[model samples]
Target: MQKYTVLLLINFFLLLANYSSAAANDSFTLGVIADCQYAEQANKGTRYYTSCPDKLSTAVEQFNTLPLSGVLHLGDFIDRDFQNFTVLNTISSVLNTPLYHVLGNHEFSIDDSLKMRVPETLHMPARYYSFEINNWLFIALDGNDVSTYGWPKTSKRHKRNIALFNTKYKGHEDWNGAIGAKQLKWLERKLNTAQTQKQPVVLLSHFPIYPENNHNLWNAQEVLTLISQYSTVKAWFNGHNHVGNYAQKDGVHFVTFHAMLDTDSTAFSTIEFSPNQLVINGQGRQPSMVLPIN
Candidate 1:
C-alpha cells in the first residue's frame, strides 16, 4: 500500500508540471473591427462621404477565416438602427471566433428602428466587463474613457447621434474626454486587483484614453494620474475618431484602423507579445513600427 501511494503522488506532480509548461508557451491572435455600422447601407441618402463603409462586408468575410483567438469591434457596429437585428445576429453568429464589442457613440445613438431598446437580444451583458484567457486579462469598457461624452439627443447633433446613445445615455451630461465617476471607480478596483496579482492588463474602449488617442480624455491628466500609479496596466486600445489618424502617448500606443466605410477599405492589426516586447502592425494603412521595452 505504501509503495502504490508514493507512485500516485509522483504521477500527479509530473502531470501538474506538464500542464504549467504547456500554458506558458501558448499564444493567440485576435481580429479587431472598428465602426462596421452593418445595419446601414453605404451612401445612405446623404452626401457624407467623409464617413461610411463600402467594404465592410468583404472584410468581415475575411475575419470569418476565424483562427483568431477571438475578435472585437471597437464600436459603431451599426448606425442609428438598433432594430437592424438581422445584421447584428448575422455577424455575431457568423464570426468564427467569439466576438466582443466596445460600445461606440453610434451604438447608443439608436434611431427610428426599434426605438433604441435596451436589453435586446443582440447585446451580450452589462456595459463594463472583463475576461481572462490563456492567463491574460482583457477589459472592455462600455463607453469612452476621456470626457465621457455620449449619444444623448440633447441637440440636433445629439439627436442624430442619440439614435444609438439614447438608451441609457440620454439625460446624461455629454462628455468628450472624461471617465465618469462610476467607470473610474470600477477601473480602480480592477486595476488594483490586477496589480496585486502581478498579472498584466489590457484596456479597450471606444474613445481614446491617452494623449495619442487624438481626442483627449475629458481629464486625460487625471486618467494618467491614476494609470501611473499602477505597473500592471500594459496597453490601452480604442477605435473612435476613425482613420487617417494615429498616435502614441507615454508608453501606451493608441491605434486607429482605417475606416471600413472609406476607400482606404478594410484593414486588420496584429499584436505579437513576448515577455520582453509587444509588437503591433496594421494591414492596410499606417506604417508599422516597433516599441522596445524600457
Candidate 2:
C-alpha cells in the first residue's frame, strides 16, 4: 500500500510538470494600444489630440522594455490631417516588436485624394489580414471596408455604405462602419481553416461588435452571428469608444480598449497569452483582466 501511494505521488508530480512545460511553451505576450489619434489640433471634448505623440512615445519606450511578440494599435492613428501620420510613425518607430494597425473611421477623415493612401501609409499588408503567433491565430479586420468615409465616392463600398445607412443602419452612428460581405466571407474561410487546425482565434478591430452600443460596428449583428458559428474564436479586441467596455458571450471576450486620445493620462496594456488563459496587464487608465480560454 505504501509503494502504491508513492507511485501515485510520482505520477501527480509528473503530470504537474508536463502541464507547466506545455503552458510555458505556448505562452507569449503582446502590447495593445488604441486610438493614439495624433494631430496638432485643439482638444475636442475629452480627446486631447496633441498629447498623442508624447504619450505614444512614452508608451513605446515602456513597450521596448518588455519581451513582447508584437504590438497592435487599434486604429485612429490620426484625428484628421494626413501629415499627422508621419509624426505618429516617427514616435512608434522605436518599438522593438512588430506593430499592427487596424483601419479606423478617423483614419479616413482626410482629403478625398488621400483616402486610398491610408493602408499604404500604415504599411498594412492588407486592409484585413491574419497572422499566427505561439500557435494562436490573430485576425485583423478592417471595419471601415464598407463605410461612408473610408471609400471613394465612386467605389462600390461607398455606395453600399450609403444604402445601408439609408435603410438598415438609419439610426446608427455614421462614424461607425461595417465589415463588407466579401470581407465577411473571407473571415468565414479563415475561421473555418482555424477551426480545422484547432487553432484559437483572437480578432482585432477598430470597432466593437458586441454589448449593443452606439459605437459598435455598423453590421455588428451580422459579424456576431458569423463569429458565433465558429467555436475557435476566443476573443475580439477593439477600440473606438474612448471610455472602454467589456462583455463576454458564448465564451468569447469582447474588449473595447480605452482610447489613448481620451484623456491627459495614457491607456495601453500588455496581454500575456497562455494555453488556457490571457492575462492583461493594463497601464495608466486601462483595466487589467484575466480571461479564461476554455
Candidate 3:
C-alpha cells in the first residue's frame, strides 16, 4: 500500500511539473478579425455592410475579457466612404488590447485626395511594418503598395499597375495588388533576421499568396517563392477572400480569415500560440483549427 501511494504521488508531481513547464513557455494569444468593412450603406448581396459597427463592438468586448497580447484587424475596415472610418474607429477604440491594422484594397475606395491619408487614418505606424511578441516576429505586408486603387489616377504606379494587371491578370479581379520590389526586399531582410535569430514568423496581409485563387495577391507567386525559402515562416494570415481558406505548403500554414461583413454570424478568432502548436479558437462563422509547428 505504501509503494502504491508513493507511485501515485510521483505521478501527480510529474503532471504538476509538466503543467508548470507549459505555463512558463513564451506562449501568447492574439485576437484576429478580418474585413469588418463597415459602411452606412445598405446590404450589398451577402455583405451586411451596415452590421459591421455592432459586430466589431461585440468582438472587441469579447476580446477585452481575454488575455490577448494584441488584436489584429485584417483590413477592409470600411467598404467605401472615407467618413465611415469615424464610426468604425469609435467601435475599435474600446478594445483593451493593442490594435494592429493591415491595409486592404477597399480601404482606398474613396476620393483620390484621401488615398495617402489611409495609413494615418487607420493609425498604422506604416503601410507595412513588423512587430515582435514573445520572440515571434509578425510581419505585416501592404499588398496594396502597388495597386490600382491606392494611388491617384494620374500616378505612375497606378498607370503601371493597371497596365500590368491588364496584360497578366486580365481574367482575375483587378482589386488584388502586389508587394513592390522595395517592400519585397524589405520583407526578405526581415525574414533573414528572423531566420538568423531562429524566431518564427507570422505574416499578416490583406491578400493570400497560396491556392492560386482569384483573390490572391497580384504577385502571389513571387511572394510564395520568397516565403517558401524560409523555414522560420510558420504561417501567413490574411483576409480579402471573404469565404476563407487554408492551405499548407513547405511546413507553412496559409490561413485566409472570413470577412466580418459576410452573413449575419459575424466572424472573428483568437489564436493561442505555444512552442509546439497553434490553437485557433474561432467565433461565429470562423472555424477553429489546430496547427502543429514543425
Clashing pairs in 2: none
User: How should the candidates be ordered by lDDT, best one leading?
Assistant: 2, 3, 1
What is the alpha-carbon lDDT of model 1 when measured against the actual structure? 0.60
lDDT of each: 0.60, 0.92, 0.92
Q: After superposition, how far is residue 136 of candidate 3 from its true place, in Å?
A: 0.5
Each model's Cα RMSD: 7.4, 2.2, 3.2
Each prediction's number of clashing residue pairs: 23, 0, 0
Give the per-residue lDDT digits (tens) of candidate 1, residues 1-294.
999999999999999999778754655667776666554445644222324333445555776764567777777676656665455666467666787777676665555343234324446566668887666678887554322234333445444444433553344445443456678889899899998997777787766655544354544566678876877777777766665355555565555554454434455565665444556666664345564433
Better of 1 and 3 by lDDT: 3
lDDT of 2 by residue, 124-153 (tens): 998999999988999999999877799888
Q: Give the TM-score of candidate 3.
A: 0.92
Q: What TM-score do all the candidates reach, one by one?
A: 0.71, 0.93, 0.92
Name the regions of candidate 3 deviating beyond 4 angstroms: 1-23, 166-171
Query: Total clashes, candidate 3?
Result: 0
Ranking by TM-score: 2, 3, 1
